[model samples]
Target: MARKEFQHYEAVSAAVPGDGAYSAAIAVKGLGAGGAPTFHRVLQDQTFKTALAADQAAVQELERLIDVTSEGELMFAQD
Candidate 1:
């Protein structure tokens, strides 16, 4: 059995609504039928109180989806 190849994408957070909150976006990349790379949005407008907080939350979510620890360090999941 061959392991499927996967791409890693960084979660981005941007300011929105002119408030302290931020909107998060994650890109999904895949190989098209023509064997060309394609990119699309998997998530958008995920609100968070602050940009840094949003980015940290995004990283944790990504780690959960990818089943990998953040830099081999332990992170507790929030309730």
Candidate 2:
């Protein structure tokens, strides 16, 4: 049987000094094995004008990283 897993993401604006453009901080939380949730920084200080845009970019990045195709197929990466 396949083990069940859960993931959650959050994006927030992180503006830096002298940089006119806005950046985003993306955080991910994973749950598995009925254990404590694990936290990770997927993306940090990524360029985005707004929180909504940053969120969209973060999702796209995650999809690409996980090899999710445009046709909605999920592919696992080979080691």
Ten-residue region with minimum lDDT total, candidate 2: 1-10
TM-score of each candidate?
A: 0.37, 0.37
In model 2, the runs with Cα more than 4 Å from the true position are 1-21, 32-46, 67-79
Error of 1 at 4 (Å): 14
Residue-wise lDDT of candidate 2 within 12-62, one digit each (tens)?
222222255544323332322344323223345456666566556545544
The runs of at least 3 residues in candidate 1 whose Cα sits more than 4 Å from the true structure, single-residue gaps closed, are 1-20, 31-46, 67-79
Candidate 2: the clashing residue pairs are none
Which whole-number lDDT from 0 to 100 does residue 37 have in model 2?
27
lDDT measured at residue 47 in model 2 versus the true structure, 0 to 100: 63
